[model samples]
Target: MTSASMISPGDILTRAEIRPILGGSAYGGICPAIEERNVILYSDHEVAKKFGYHDGWLSENDTLGPIFEYTGAGKSGHQSLTQSGNKAILQHVQSGRTLHVFTRVGKITGTDTKTHRYIGEFAIDEEQPFVPRQGLGEDDLIRTAIVFRLRPTGEFDRSDSDTISPAPSTSAEFVPLTITSDMLEAAAVTRNAFTSSSLRSRSNSASLDAAASGKIAPVQAVNVSEFQRAASAATTVRRRKALLIEAYVNQLEAQGHSVGSFQLQIEGRTTTLRTDFFDATDYTLYEAQGSSDRDAVRAAFSRLLDYRRYVRHDGLQYEPKTVALLPGRPDPDLEALLASYRISLIYQGEDGKFSSAF
Candidate 1:
């Protein structure tokens, strides 16, 4: 705890605790005055007042997970993070300091000292975390504000939420959706682009007349039956990963294996670390990663290692066999890496069957 690890998420230090560690009692939400300080105590009010609200309006939209947004510096027209008071905060991440996040636990109007609750600590998720997005300024002028996404580090060591349920019925087919341009047009038509029923009628008549005269290209009716990936790329990746886990779970259950998730509350931590699924019949804890690429595989490795400690903290009678449910077969190097750690790797194939990689 001597280094940055000392400052975990969900840690609310009293002045005595903080002053000794941070070397000063002058810490506040954002103190540009102390440029050398790595720790910044943030409250939601300050976020709303200083940079976020274009019109002094602070809502839940202010902070999403790992994403704390603010109006970019500048007032004239388009804004940039470098131009805003938030510039200091964004630039501070370059120092590689953990950002301590606090929210009001009592009345929102309560003072920072009394109301602030430590939610978690965050780190810069991307090399460049700030990007200007379209927004309105306090003056209601069309402007750009910087959106920053910060990933949560295990600073808080909070209990993990239970995210597993029973396996989805394998009797039902898992399908991917397909989308077509004509389907988009049909959706647009149903949404009513015209001003009134009269306009709609006229537009329909025009469409029929154009087809009858053969003056316009005929649009074939499109059936959008498959699940069109209507989500963002991040969402799509995560969804596909989730499906891989679900399919694996279904496969395991089809073989009469008892499956449930492991939610162990480590004695010392505020949050719990959970495994994706556990086999009661054999006491196997499965870690399902929605990603299989290098970085994700690396993270999954760390999680498995930490869970070993967590299991110890739980002091359960029997240790569970730890297995990772990966999206695909790992590269040889990665497979060897997992084997070196004695972690079992189970992957789904292109044919959708789950297989053991030993």
Candidate 2:
């Protein structure tokens, strides 16, 4: 249908349909100015179509005065009902406006293992709006919720015409490369190599101790105190190394970066010593490692006689917050599209307080 036929001259049309035609032209595109002049002309077009008015067009001759009058009177009636003894009834109807839309998509029916028999059919409510009424009795206001079921037919058109068109493509643009299994496998191998190296270092020291014990049967008396001190130091070093690696991984993950392999740099090493890393991009590696260290230290320090009293004890607490900033207000086209869905901006707030300018 022609735009003129769909929207008559001097008749109201949504701001969305007229903006594009007037934006760059002489009419300097004042949004608020246009909205005030427009009145929503179409209502129950789908209902009209189902009752044999297939075109879904309303001529000037169509009597819409009664329907508009009913809506106006209903609003006044609701107010009057509230002021009178029927305040309960008014409240009942007021409650209906707050009813939420519940939608279920793709509900599949089936049996777990046995063959399931399909029932004949059942009535399904599509766009059900809650309506409230008063019951017959003093102080007895009844709110009866009714669901209106709409059968599938060629009546209502649910297509939205204002959806944004995708950007045009050029032949020179690079196509996205697909990640293959081989790439992931290679990454896994790299991680495993680091882990193996760390394990070997730890095992070699243990083996050396065992070999020394085997060679010296009834060995020369070495200081038991020295042996214990060395062993404790080695354990501490290993624990610290593990904690640092974990912390690094957690930090990277928290920043939305995937943890690949941990690289350790010794005092004079040119190459980074690789170690196995956990793959968790949703958390911070540094923070995780810090938390782990804090817990471990707290446990270890509690056993120490001299150092335990000096260590400041604090409970673990970690919270991450993210803030996003936009360049400007929402696009005019986008705002208009959202308004068609009956959504309105109620308030805009700053970091703490509400602002009326928005």
Candidate 3:
């Protein structure tokens, strides 16, 4: 095996030359050369497609720069961080190992040699190292996968064919819930599915059984259209806030007032933050908190401060009044904090009426 110094960026090499020069397996997506003090990553778009994933590409330019998303090592089932290759990549900074990346270009004709184009070095993004995504595995079953965010350390190959489009914004329109028997039944089922510990235990047991029997467990496929509906059915704090907004919007409509929400898409960011509710009749922007805790109260205040800048009324000359919406009244200190900023507080009383405090 030759020394690691032979490999350089933009150099094309075959599988046989990699092991002798890099000191790692010449196969697999992740190759860790311990003696070489290098962690080599290979991004093969063709192989990824077989597993129902399209990875190993650069994203559209953002504030920081374009980031490369590389799928972690796992061909089937759930990809765990505990694996050796993933662990090595995760702790590369602390371990003092350099990361080298390569992408498959093509193979030589009439032979068994595969060609790879070295794409320079990279480091994991400190803000968000990796993201958990759901995709089909090699077995064609849904599984959780890990995608690592890598930032370039130096000049690297940038090609239009290797760049990916920006991800879709996460924005949802408000949905009014109707009080019907079937709707109640569906809600009850969803609540049990989320909160019941026994159900979770049974699910774990079923997974084990499937593994023992060499059978893959069935799971729902990813569908963008049903994302909001599935999110609303969860028993999370966000879900509770959605319900609160729905109730308040209904009340405003009953009083012959127009109400809706605002979707704000900030530049240089992929996510779109949506306000809880906006009263078009009176030009008031509402930010809802699921709980009256201090943290939730503080976050609601911060969001209101940010959202008010873009919120506008067509005919009004003044800015919209900012109000914090909660399920119940907060402590005196929290209320004082909101009042100091000149932000109003609105809570639902036990009798199901909205009470405002300023």
Candidate 4:
């Protein structure tokens, strides 16, 4: 095995070949080759399935390109981000280290030695890196897992069959919901938007604002507005959705309806689900979307269906109404889709009043 820096993408090596070069236990999935300034990630999807887990899959190309979801270390219990390889994977960018991935291909005919296929280099997705997931542990119990979202930085073995499949439809005759006291605290937790990209744009905008107000030299504002504009454009979708939720909550409260959100922990799942807003007085559950476009409306509809199970809150004699809240009325086709599922639609009109369809 050559040094880590010299190892190119698609270079396969065995544990025996990697040990001397990487200086760590060759058996571990996350190996830090200290001398070479590289972090080698070994993903064995086949083995993961045998343990009742499915991860280390490649996703189709989207706007940001392909993403590989890799499960972090630890076979049982909840995995911590601040410990071991999880920390290394998180801070690899700041430490100036490269992430090289390898997937177990097969075992040598009869021996215990397994071969790996070098996939290529990857970087943690800056927007969202760690995703909480549920997987069975070694003890056959459900445990919390951390999935690291990795974006490819170079050419990888795309011919592998481990492509990420779309999530299965959530429609079922019976969906279980586990009530937890942490619902309010979890719902209040803000989504993280402080990425490096957002920070750079904020600094530039602050500098430009100071310059425009005569607090700094006018020349310092050169080309800063363009960067600031780009940053604002990047966050438009999230901001729009947030604003819609806030306005709807206020409207509900003004109408004598108690508005709140819930973070639900489904039975047997480590990941939790959060509702956009719930009308306690009227017994309505809402799933809001910023845009009424086809994709956005479809997503909101799907989520609303999944959340219907939560409408049967404790002490309630009947299930609450499921509603899809949109910034504006959806097209006739989309409205029909919601109606087919018996989901009510509520949209804000030009007059600032909400229009509803039951």
Candidate 3 has which clashing residue pairs, if any?
none
List model 1 lDDT by residue over 265-308, tens digit each. Answer: 44332222345456665666666666788877887787777665
Best by lDDT: 3
Measured by TM-score, the strongest candidate is: 4
lDDT per residue (tens digit) for residues 94-213 in model 3: 566778888888999987678888787898875456655555799998665667778888778766556654445432332111111111112221322222232234442342223222
The alpha-carbon root-mean-square deviation between model 2 and the true structure, to one decimal in Å, is: 33.5
Candidate 3 lDDT score at position 339: 91
Model 4, span 20-74: residue lDDT tens:
6655566788987667677888888766776656655544455887778888777
lDDT (0 to 1) per candidate: 0.45, 0.22, 0.64, 0.61
**Which residues of candidate 3, in runs, are more than 4 Å off?**
1-5, 165-358
For candidate 4, the clash count comes to 0
Rank by lDDT (best first):
3, 4, 1, 2
Residue runs of model 4 more than 4 Å from their true location after superposition: 1-5, 19-24, 164-320, 323-358
Count clashing pairs, candidate 2.
13
What order do you get sorting by TM-score, best first? Answer: 4, 3, 1, 2
TM-score of each: 0.39, 0.13, 0.51, 0.55
How many steric clashes between backbone atoms does each model show? 14, 13, 0, 0
* Candidate 1 positional error at 2, Å: 44
**1-358, model 2: which lDDT tens digit per residue?**
5222343233333334433422211221111113222111122223222322111111111221100100100111111211221221112122221111111112234622211111111111111111121111112322111111112211222222211122232111111111111111121111122122321343322321222121101111222233234333333333333333333334444667644322233332121122223233332111111122333333322222222122111231332111111111234453343244322211212342212212
